[model samples]
Target chain A: MIDKPFNNKAWLFVLPVFFLVAISAIIPLMTVVNYSIQDTFGNNQYFYVGTEWYTEVLGSSRFHDALGRNLLFSGIILLIEIPLGIFIALSMPRKGFWVPVCLILMALPLLIPWNVVGTIWQVFGRADIGLLGRVLTGLGVDYNYATNWLDAWITIIVMDVWHWTSLVVLLCYSGLVAIPEAYYQAARIDGASKWKVFRYIQLPKMQRVLLIAVLLRFMDSFMIYTEPFVLTGGGPGNSTTFLSIDLVNMAIGQFDLGPAAAMSIIYFLIILLLSWVFYTVMSNFGADAPNKEVG
Target chain B: MAQISLDKLAHSYVAKPQTDADFALKQIDYVWQDGGAYALLGPSGCGKTTLLNIISGLLTPSKGHIRFDDDDVTLRSPEQRNIAQVFQFPVIYDTMTVEQNLAFPLVNRGVARSEIDRRVADMLDTLDLKDKARQRARGLSADEKQKISLGRGLVRYDVNAILFDEPLTVIDPHMKWQLRTKLKQLHEQFGHTMIYVTHDQTEALTFADKVVVMYEGEVVQIGTPEELFDEPAHTFVGYFIGSPGMNVLPCEVDKNIVHMAGAKFTLNKGYADLVGKLEIGIRPEFIDVKSAAEANGAGVAIQVTAVENIGRHKIVRGTVNGYAIDVLTDEDQSIPSDAYAVFNTSRFNVYQNSHLVRAHS
Candidate 1:
């Protein structure tokens, strides 16, 4: 074993980051912890009620419904966005004058603010004045997002796909371009089919970038609030309410600070746990495989 | 297997090449015999790689007809041409095991499963990778990864030719020799036409049956290693082939007599009215160094500068009348403080405008 030099002064350099994180993250988290374990009445009078809010929040069927909705939304968006992004990236021009044009077009949707995207889709999907709504109506289809929970879910899902698949495309594109030209030349010499080339070369090369894209899309979709709140306002009957939306409704809408605080902690832990699982599984992918035929 | 021929091959990166300067590879016609080993040897930016790429069907020549035996394959793709190429760096499918990588080409061509397994196993034994056959290719060292690349190419039995583009550049020195020998043995066993490209003279001389030397986007000479050493078609070949290379000195030729740097000598063969930048080329091994008095006014006086003792021989570095010259002698041979250098007439060559001039016997 190599001997490492010991230095107490190293901690001094870490002090700045430690203080910044405490102020920005730790302090707020501690306040939430404090609120979750106490009961607050009018004029800031409080009484200790340890673990009561946690039990109440965990046991509620409404919280379970919101959690289910959040997982379902995140799952649906991930399934649609990941493969769609890779397909679009593959179809994009790899060379010539059209490359920059295609890149700028892909980046356009990502530049729009989430609230703006939600508002635009809200107006665009209206039955009377919106083009999409009128087109569906002209086609003799019953379409109304304001009254139907399915319509609200479809509108929000489509809007999110439009605004976010481009990010995945950009990430995958960068990964694809970074591969050396030699690999392609060798593949051609080997008489590999287009699909085999993608399977053996392109997909493996893009694994790291795809991991980042999946995690980002999962976390963002799970914590979705601004866009859906603007578009469906947690739906006609909580059909589109996610964890963050539910947490906001519980804390600010109903002023149930204790229960909301408990729910927030659980939400943070879920995101953290899921991201860690994703990172571990994705990074270990193909690193260790059974000694079997590649096919 | 089929013999390959290039008819007036040339290439230019420019869309419309206006002049010869625009061409990266000048027009040339040559034939590589079936199952022959040929090396494209040259310095960097000399179009050797470009020529190899053209032959491998990775790049199409601007003006050329490439024929395998009789069929013109000029515009054919690499796959259509049935070619295999090992690149400078290892290009292995990271997800596949060593055996899978070796079997990939055979599988793609729809070879029988038993045949693929047999060939892959044979290749694994040949490459000394049998122990790692089931391990992922991504975890191998650079040289081992390169071996997999070679195995992939060699596993296929029906490829027209195997092209190697400095495939040993990434290998360590000790391993380079071993791999080179392994490649030569494989060539002999398989008898597949191979074209190896390298800038190193040792690699070219050792690997190829015929070495095609290129300079400034043009092939200057194509000959066996001994022929390249004995009779260089151009001055660049003589300068490029040897350890210290050949020493070229400006000389005036008249009939059979040659006037050198402040000295004169008679030649056995006569040259007929040679003109335009005449010089005499002689390898360092052919030059003799002796004491000035023993020369008896037959040789030119040279100022001995430095002597390097290389285990088997000593190289005498000096200048004769402001022209640099090198002489090779036995290590035990004592260099006289005042040295006189004589060129062996039988081994000397005459060059006019950098091209060798034929002698009138």
Candidate 2:
């Protein structure tokens, strides 16, 4: 049988979104591309530099340090948040009045603006006035996020976890709720232990959502800017200076357009490459993971 | 292997159930014999699943005692009770192979590794899943997953009973019959007390030696398939059992004579002082279609409306005195316009207020 004729008119429905994305993302990306390849002193004057800035940004230890810090931060946050989020979701009430209460409380951190969260934590981590700092200091610990490198890193990591763990919790909670009651009943009849039920049933059912959680947390933490900028300001000797903060310092702070533009392009490509790698490895792992059947 | 007994069992989802309507299952005291295959047959919301859950210890009845061979297991968990249940939909562990899924319960019970392997292998062969033994359960079709579910229940030899809650609901029609026969064979081989629940009459009648019919949270009748068809205990049973169900007509009863739709029908037994809403029930198979002359001024003259040829038998639909009645006739039986519908008095059942009323001796 002849296949139905292709519907060319479907393009009309897609034109609006295509034009919107072109204007909002593609055009700006092209401008960044243009700036990255050229050297501009001022007043629209341009000179073709041809990969000189790429080499400079790549060779700079400052860019390297910031990239390393971003990777460490993303790694630490993912390790903490994914498991903790799943733990909290598992402990949460499956039904009754407390369900909405727990959900709304978990969502509160996510609803706060990033800058507001950073500002709140910035004041909250002050040793003299903040409850956390005062408690730690009163307990005879020399804790000061404003001056100590380790303190700064700890405070920033804690703040990031506080701000983003809710997203993971919500995703996992939805996955847990979508599981049918029959699986648990069957498990009970099978005399399965709690861990076995979780290992074989709950964990497999939550895989898709857990993948989304990992990807979102990774991308968000890697590109995290406003929170750290407001809280630590990438200070305490650049201990918490992530990649985005470093890129901003290059582009707007120093006004080093050529190097900053090149750094920005490299940053975008790094994120893209890493995310693609993550997607490929994870999707393949998911496919190869036995017992990933959904009921 | 164990005789299951439910003593004064009742359940309600409500915190404080003051009325019978609030209860999901009314007071039920019944005993299921050891090594018997029984079916709990009912329409939706009739609490068959609720009763099964109570027996399996998945649910605790509001007031009841569940006994297995003289042992009180009322407060025991399903694991402790040693019962196996297959749900309406297949509940196979997706991450495991078919063999692993079958061996799960046995392994959980700390059964020896060799024994578990032997049991799993035997179950795989029995379920015709030997080829798919090492295949992940996630990719199997619904019927195959259900077969795995059944195999999981059957793999454990120590289970007291196996409860199936509409296990064939997701199975395709052809596969349903095959799996059903396999289940019957398994029951014969193992001698496990099995309680199968379903709303489908054919599945109930074919699979069960004795069918327990439930309606509106109460057990209406519990009898063999032949008994259920021949003599229903309530109007709901009459309506819910057969294909077209039993034909129940309103009647005015006076001793042995019953007047209905301007015609009189005599009963084999007399009902003296019978009160309340009176009605007569008769199965379609027992109704006879006769020519006007052959009827010999007996039976009710009905206006024939429709004749449905149902392969094996023809159903004659007609109206007598504005009351509709159905007569099951042979395939070659010709339907005449002027036909009288006759009811075999020996097979007639009298109902008073929706319940079967026995005639005075």
Candidate 3:
């Protein structure tokens, strides 16, 4: 290797970035860490707690229930969204005037603010006067989101899917469009069926974008708060209180600063670990295509 | 294994073509014999690829029918026509291994597994890609990828014809020759009808038994390399097929004599009163450069401008009465200030309106 010139002045170039990160992220995290290790009472009086909050938060079944709910919600949304998004993207016109129109319609949901989407779904799913609820109640089905936990869950799930599936569609559309026209021509000449073309050509080409979509949707759904908070205010019976909402309730609603800080740290770690796992697994997909006969 | 025929084939990109100029391929009526290796040669935007696409059923001509052994395949798809085409750049399934890429066409047709394996193995060996058989096709070099593209076409044994559209454009210069030789060998061994499209003269001249020369959406001439070289039917052919091309000079035709550039030359055969713009065509290879004393009152004197020493021969570029003329001479020959360009009478061709005028003996 060629010898690189020894230069310590390069470190000066990183000073601005260091200060930016310290101000934006590191400083706040340190305050949370400080709170997790101490007990705070009224008038700023404090005492050393020494991991008591960590033990209580980790052992509580409320935390376990909220974590389970978050996992299930993320899982259900992903299972519905990824395939549906890919289908919508594939069905969209590849050319002509309608392409931009379809793209704009897909993007419309994403442009709406998160809480606005929640409030829109909240009124839309109201059994008293909303169109969907009125139609369901008139059709003889008992649909009430205010009291029934299952109805609340279904409403939120539907609302989330409607709001976010467009993101997945746009990502997958860009991937699909990036594929060259020659590949399609070659596939036609090879006599491949439509399914085979998708499996061997389109699917492989979309792998990178799909990985990104999965990671974003997973993290976004896992840390979901604004929509569910505005829609059901955590739920009829704490059934839809996902991790972020539960953390907010503990930190601000009940003012359990120590335990909530401890819980938030744990929540952050779990997301980091799961995202790493997802990235590792998704990036390795199709690395080595199946070989019937090895050379 | 089928003789492909194009019957009055013409295509226009526009829906309503008002004139011949609108046609991308203007009325091509030719038949490629079974087991024949033909090259469709032309410059870019000359509709060579359009004609190749029509033959492979990737395109349906605006008019006329395409037949493969009496079966009209005008409305058929590429799959229905059983045609194979290798594109300009390599088009391989990136997720497939080299062997799988080669076997794709056969697999899609539902050929027996054993047959696919055998054909793929044979193709791998033929293309010298056996060493990389298990490797993913995407990671290979461009030439290797191109070989896989060619292998995919060759793996199908019963294709009506294999069409190539500038398939070697991405290949390295050295690799182009090897792949071209391999293709020729494969064609000879299997007796498959092949139509290779290219803008390179050397590729067309070397790979084809009969070279179909096209110009501006029209088939100008169809002949062997020798025929194209010896007597180019059109002035464009004479200019396009040669290295320095043919020297075309405006002239007046009178009975059995031709007068050009203030000089007179006699023809072997008499020509009746020719109409339209008249000219004489001669290849640079046939013209001899002589000193003034050596010319002996024959030929015309040209003001020599430049000389290029191209290894085996020297190209003498000169101008006579404002018309540029090139003469090929042995590399060792010395140039004199008073250079005379003697036309080889037997090789001279007369043209009327850019089309060759045959002399009546």
Give me the candidate number with maximum TM-score: 2
Model 2 C-alpha lDDT per residue in residues A223-246, reported as the tens digit of each score:
999977887788887987888998
Model 3 lDDT tens row, B156-275: 888888899999998999999988998899899888899999999999999999999999999999999999998899999999998989999899998879988778889888888998
Alpha carbon deviation, residue A270, candidate 3 (Å): 2.4
Which should have the higher lDDT, number 1 or number 2? Answer: 1
The sequence of per-residue lDDT tens digits that candidate 1 reaches over residues A48-167 is 999999899899999899999999999999999999999999898889999999999999999999999999999999999999999999999899998899999999999999999999
Better of 1 and 2 by DockQ: 1
After superposing candidate 1, which stretches have Cα over 4 Å from the reference? A1-4, A289-295, B294-296, B304-317, B327-337
Write candidate 3's Cα lDDT for A58-114 as tens digits.
Answer: 999999999999999999999999999999999999999999999999999999999
Error of 1 at A263 (Å): 1.4
DockQ value for model 2: 0.47
- Determine which window of 10 residues in candidate 2 chain B has minimal summed lDDT: B260-269
TM-score of chain A of each: 0.96, 0.93, 0.95
Candidate 2 vs candidate 3: the TM-score winner is: 2
Q: Please give the DockQ score of every candidate, comma-separated.
A: 0.48, 0.47, 0.47
- Which segments of candidate 3 are over 4 A away from where they belong? A42-52, A289-295
Residue pairs that clash (backbone atoms under 3 angstroms), model 3: none
The prediction achieving the highest lDDT against the true structure is 1
In order of listing, the candidates' clash counts read: 0, 2, 0
